[model samples]
Target chain A: MPRADARANRAALLASAAQRFAIDGADVALEKIARDAGVSIATLYRHFPHREALVAATYAREIEDLAEVPDDGSGSVALARWLLRFVEFARTKRALGDLLHAPGADHPPARGVLLDALDRILTRGRADGTLRDDRDPADVLALLAGLWTLPDDDTWPVRADRLAGFVLDGLTTTR
Target chain B: MPRADARANRAALLASAAQRFAIDGADVALEKIARDAGVSIATLYRHFPHREALVAATYAREIEDLAEVPDDGSGSVALARWLLRFVEFARTKRALGDLLHAPGADHPPARGVLLDALDRILTRGRADGTLRDDRDPADVLALLAGLWTLPDDDTWPVRADRLAGFVLDGLTTTR
Candidate 1:
């Protein structure tokens, strides 16, 4: 396969893996992931070599998504969007569970990445007078920890969104 | 012992159990609890036939504490006070762990009591225009679930307070 085709296939596989992992958990079959990515099982193994490698790569992709702060100039809006992403990240992380701790899974520092992302948004918001300066990013993160405790049922998404919204409202300046 | 003395001893035992359980967890020595209550082992046993009975009674006391909504007339202030108590309750609940689920423990319906307490407060707050009507009491309860997730360390009290404050801010009408 050409280099560009290989890159596309790798990206597709990662995306498929992330989606399946979030929905079906980390034990989801690699072959099903490859099929969803419109690739063969051989292609999946050629790229990832093993399940741990694929999970780690997908996790890295998630952290990268969180780190990429939009340059929208509105801190509140950026933070709001980021919070929704954070909720999704929390869900995926919960789904990933012990897989991230398994031997040979080389994922990045999630807490550090998340705190930095939150700090950047909070700093921007405070400077722009869009967010309250009373809260620390760590405090916000701690408050958002409620996301992890929410029951993993059908109403999880709605409950997670509401919890995030409450955090956001608390962080925003009283207009 | 007189009826009033017996009642006092029982109340003291429950209070002592709540404190010790919150600090040292459910397995704290029964003798220690008896000592803390300034009572003999026989008195403690007379009031609570077994550890499960003590745990159940302690749990019921917590629910009653939560159910008592102060008529302070300011829903925000009342809710704020209640949130702090709720945090303490969460801590004690965490410490209780499986004790509450022990086969013979006859604790009241915790979730129902909590939701009803919150509903009463939210209704009062909405009536007095002290709280935002957009969020449901259940949503507030869900958001406050962060208290349960805080690490049970030295900083837990501080972190729990901050998280509760954030939730309070979210529920209060913007001034």
Candidate 2:
């Protein structure tokens, strides 16, 4: 098989596996993922030697690109940008939420990408007098952790907007 | 048994049940709760009628008097008062967290009590121009939902304080 075709097949399998993992959780069958990806089982095995490798790699790919999500400036604008990203990921992340939070599990890749992004923006906001000095980025992250409980349906967007707006105001609105 | 003695037994059972509920969750066994109360199993059944009845009544009695927790004048002071009440209840309430959030569960008796208290103070703050108009009491309550996830240990008090303070600042801070 051509190298380019092999690479395309690997990408297809990851995409398919990601959806299955998100929906069916971490234990979905490899054969099912291969069928969904429209790739042979042999190709899935070639790309991922073990099930954990497959799950972790697919999950990492989902969040890896977020490391580059630009901060649209600072203060509320930057905070707002990062929050939307967080909310979006959280919406889909709930399907695999157990895995993400599993105790003693290996720390997932791309873990700090979003939190670091938030730290940068919050640091800028603090310097500019737009953000309060006492708030911690970790606390803000914990506050956002509640977002995981929100329902995944039409009303989710509205609820997410309310939560994100509240957090944003809490951090950026100074007395 | 005399009426006064029965009342005393009931009060003692509730105190034991409340402490166990906070530490062990809403599902702690009635027999265990009875032992802690130093009361007989027959007496617990007589007073509560059933396990659910005991759980509900005990939990209700915990937050029941919150109706009278004084709302100091207005603004941050009043907001702070209500938040402390909220954090304290949330600490124990986590025991019944599943029931509180269960889909289609009748809105728990305690659901709107704290929200209404928050609304009262926030309304006062807005009217007096000491609080931001853009904030909502329900939104603050949602942020406080994160309080349930904090670990059960010494740090809980400190973490709750931080979360409560963040929500207060979010509401009270003027830009």
Candidate 3:
């Protein structure tokens, strides 16, 4: 493992990249991302040789963060809460879809990471019987995929909140 | 008023356009649509001066079809029934969003039409107390927006079906 300062630099660069990707497109300049993260351009490339590598790593960390959303005692409730955070993930990752799903690529680099997190949460819910067994993690992910289609306009935040609530209500408890 | 044969030609052209637009894109050739509809190119142009006009009109007709989905007698059940139909509407309309949301356009031409249908269904549900009053037609549409985001893979149909069921369950009578 790298030393603490190196790790911190990596984290900061990734955070900067995610923020810029959300605000602008994924093609926001590497120099700007490095400056925003308080690191030099050389440091960023030292950590991640290619921009795609940085994007993939940042996305992996996001999935890790999603996986780490603490259980709120209620299995279904925990999944519901995690989904509220997932809206940002869904929308932000969409900006990177074209990049991650580059020509000839088999799957999005982020997809498996995201799906695995979903699987863990869903598996816990099923184990506890707090969620509808009939619902599959794959299906849940597919349902959440709708988030990518929303118009990013003034009403998007409100719409996203409503959409998240809809998913939570629909996915948990017996039908 | 258009004569009987002229009216038939108009309906055929619109039907052909909608079919072609769904299978292909909104930019499908006018000649091809006319040929598919068994009308001449002149008839297609006469009916719709511009491709945008045909897209808007076909989209309007789709909304009318949605509005005409008969209530299954139960207010909530009626809305549930209509949402299954709404998927077809949502997916088919995805191809037309660009055409319908041309420069300076405030909203998709079909939005008000579909939302009106949703509003009527929801209002009835509220009156009957079978649906949650807090959920508005706009919110429901936002939730359903996920419908258009699904991948066009073999699994799409299954995912779409699950998503529709999720929406119905989430919006209906309280737990």
lDDT of candidate 1 over A29-121, digit per residue (tens) = 989999999999999999988886787788886677788898887789888999998888787676443342221223335555666888899
**Which numbered prediction scores highest in lDDT against the true structure?**
1
Tens-digit lDDT track of model 3 for A1-175: 8899999999999899888887776678999999999999999999999887888887776667776757556668778778878877666575555443232225555665666777778878888888777777656665655455566676666767777777777767755
DockQ of each: 0.18, 0.21, 0.20
lDDT of each: 0.76, 0.71, 0.73
- Compute fnat per model: 0.38, 0.31, 0.34
Per TM-score, the best of the predicted structures is 3
Model 2 chain B lDDT-worst window of ten: B97-106
Residues A49-87, candidate 2: write the lDDT tens digits: 877567767767656655555655657677778788878
Q: Which of candidates 1 and 3 reaches a greater DockQ?
A: 3
When 1 and 2 are scored with DockQ, the better candidate is 2
- Supply candidate 2's per-residue lDDT for A89: 76
- CA shift at A96, candidate 3, in angstroms? 4.6
By summed lDDT, the worst window of 10 consecutive residues in model 2 chain A runs over A98-107
